[model samples]
Target: MSHTPAPSRYDRQPYRRSGRSGLLLPTLSLGLWHNFGDVDRHDTAREMLLGAFDRGITHFDLANNYGPPPGSAEVTMGRVLREDLAAYRDELIISTKAGYRMNPGPYGEWGSRKYLLASLDASLKRLGLPYVDIFYSHRPDPDTPLEETMGALDQAVRSGRALYVGLSNYSAAQTREASAILRRLGTPCVIHQPRYSMLDRHVEGGLLDVLAEEGIGCIAFSPLAQGLLTEKYLASIPADSRAAKGGFLKPTDITPGRLAALRGLKELADARGQTLAQLALSWVLRQPVMTSILVGASRLAQIDDALGIIAAAPLNDAELAAIDAALALENATT
Candidate 1:
């Protein structure tokens, strides 16, 4: 099938500057952390990628170890890029991360200079790109010196392998330290990717403040909390659900208390004329520091649902109060 990108793609979506940088990323970005691997059909992945681009989502996030077997997601993405999105490559913001285990050995993982540099090379090879728009450290390595890790990120940019550098899963203090090092190295950290959702508010405790102070952009991953914030898990976990499969989101994580909270949030979502997932995404985007929300989709409909968040009105003060009250109830029960 021939795929022509929507002519009005830019008109429908909103773009925000990434921190203090001149780069403007779409308000919503698609992540290839799930459902774009060798285990999945290539045609479906192609559809989702084209669908996202058509809907004005210019950013596509991936990691070195996104597939179940690891590295296959990038392979899948590479194919799609060549077959479908090659013409519009200049308009896209492609990002990939390193630091997790990609192969067996002392040098296969972490934030060491060797690991990061090698991993970026391997990621570029898999992605079939000369340079990714943003390359991230993926996570902090307590075993390695922060200087080494930050230096590797700086090198990635200086070497022209990545246009910008970012960090993920770093705490507030860690971000402050890393950003300072990157700044000194003459490669300022452009973005920070953290897990932010209604249920996961760790970023709010201090990370948001740190990013704001440092003028670093924030694009939150797991914005739907691995689909927990969605209505799919409201009544019961489907057999095909991520929780049922017992990987990152275990069935036990869905306790009775969580169910009750989901129910309350669902009512609120209904009242707001949105789905719980949209509400969760909207809530995260309400923060001015948030440049984008990274969402994963298993199907075209999921992508559509996530894109709807951009059009939804920001949650009002009364709605925010009600959400806080519901969360308080959830905390009491848990």
Candidate 2:
């Protein structure tokens, strides 16, 4: 069956220009890091993809090793692209990354030129795309030269495998160095994807400043701290929750103090008529350089909740101070 996108899709969502670039991304971009794997329900994944686009989420983020089996997420997205989103390809900003273990060989992973280029080919094949909008380094490889990694990124654009290139999980220093190299190569780094949230503020230490200086937009992943910022873990971790799954977020991560902090945040969110998740997202968006937030959703309702935050008022000085106090209380209690 052909999919008919909502006519009002562009009316509700706001777009932000990716620093110094002609690209404009929706405030909320859907990430396929989870819940679109072969093990997941195809129907649900299909619904979420189409639903997100219908709500004006034009950007979709993916990586070479996103699924449990690695690369399966791209395969799932490939199906959606072919079956449902083929007509809207021009309206979409699909991106994929390489820099993790996808195979067991000398060139299977890392930022090497050979690996990065090969991974892009494989990702393009899996995603069934001639080229991706943005191809990322995924993570910095300490063992590889930055030039080799970034050169491959430049080559990706020049070779027509990617329209633009980006970096993810790189330190402030690494990002600076990589950006310089890409600039010299004449393919300026357009965006940086970092793990950021109220709970994880490592980006503030220097990364954000580097991005601002380099004219690279930032799209934060895990803005809800991998679900910790939500009310789902305020009391106890549900069996179906990602924390219980024991990968990135562990059950032991939810301590008594953390729960207390979540409760405090929940109270603040209630006062604003927002969910804990929305409040967390709002806090992350407070940064002027934060171009977008990459969100993952297992269900349609989660997407709805995230989209709702776009209209919520920005955090004022008092609210920001209160959030800091709530977080500080966690440190005191911990």
Candidate 3:
């Protein structure tokens, strides 16, 4: 079946400028890190993509090694584009990264020019696009010089493989240096992708400050903290939950103290007439440096719940204080 995007898609959602760049990204971006893979149903993936676009999510983030087998998410996205979104190609912000391992070998991973450029080509082929809107160096490679990595990003744009370049999982110092190199090369780092949430506040110590000072956009991945911030693990881990599946998140990660914090946060969310996920997302976006939040959905309803935060009110000072208080308990136990 052919899919048609709704005409009223862009009416409600607002787009934020990516740092000092000319590119504008929807406040909510969809990530194809989990469900859009060969192991998942194609029709359901297609529905999630279409549903996201219908709700005004124009940015779709992917990585070279997202799938369990690797690169399958991009193939799934390619099919969705060919089947449904080809006509609206110019209206979307498609992004992919290459710094993680895509194949087994020395040249398979890292920020080396060889790996970054070759990975971009592979990603483009899988995505069925001539160029990605934003190409990211998925993580900083300590083994490679910063100049070499930044130069690869610069060359990616210069060669017309990517329009803009970004850095992911880089520390504040690394981002500052990378941004300087990209700036000197005349392709300023447009954004930074980091794992940030109430549970993970490493970025707040200095990375957020660096982004603010350098005028770089910040898009948080894992804003839901691997479903720990959601209602899924309130009582017991669902059989289908990520924690139960045991990869990135484990059953042991959720202790009684963390659950207590979640319960407290959930009550606050309920008082505010929003879900815990919504509250967590809103908290991440409260920072001005946050250009958007990347969320992964197993179902269309999850996407809907995430997009619903766009219309919800921002968290005020009192609410923030309450959240910090609840988090303080989790921290104390840790």
Using TM-score as the measure, the top candidate is: 2
CA displacement after TM-score superposition, residue 236 of candidate 2 (Å): 1.2
For model 1, the superposed segments whose C-alpha errors exceed 4 Å read: none
lDDT of 3 by residue, 1-334 (tens): 4667888999868999888888898999999999888999998999899989999999999999987669999999998898788989998999999998888889999989999999999999999999999999999998999999999999999999999999999999999999999999999999999999999999988999999999999999999998899999998989988999998999999998899899999999999889999999999999999999999899999988887788889899999999999987776775
For lDDT, the strongest prediction is 2
User: Considering TM-score, which of the candidate structures 2 and 3 is the better prediction for this target?
Assistant: 2
True-structure RMSD for candidate 2: 0.7
State candidate 1's TM-score: 0.98
How well is each residue in 1-334 modelled by candidate 1, as lDDT tens digits?
A: 3468999999877999989998899999999999998999988999899989999999999999998669999999888888788888999999999988888999999999999999889989998999999999999999999999999999998899999999999999999999999999999999999999998998889999999999999999998889999999887889999999999999999987888888888899999899899998999999999999898998989988888887798899999999987776666785
Instruction: Give per-residue CA lDDT, model 2, range 1-334, as digits (tens).
Output: 6689999999978999999999899999999999999889999999999999999999999999988679999999999999988988999999999998988989999899999999999999999999999999999999998989999999999999999999999999999999999999999999999999988999999999999999999999999988899888877789999899998999988988888788888899999999999999999999989899999999999999999898899999999999999887677786
- lDDT of candidate model 2 versus the reference: 0.93
Error of 2 at 118 (Å): 0.4
TM-scores of all models?
0.98, 0.99, 0.98
Off by over 4 Å in 3: 332-334
Better of 1 and 2 by TM-score: 2
- TM-score of candidate 2 versus the correct structure, residues matched by position: 0.99
lDDT of 3 at 97: 97
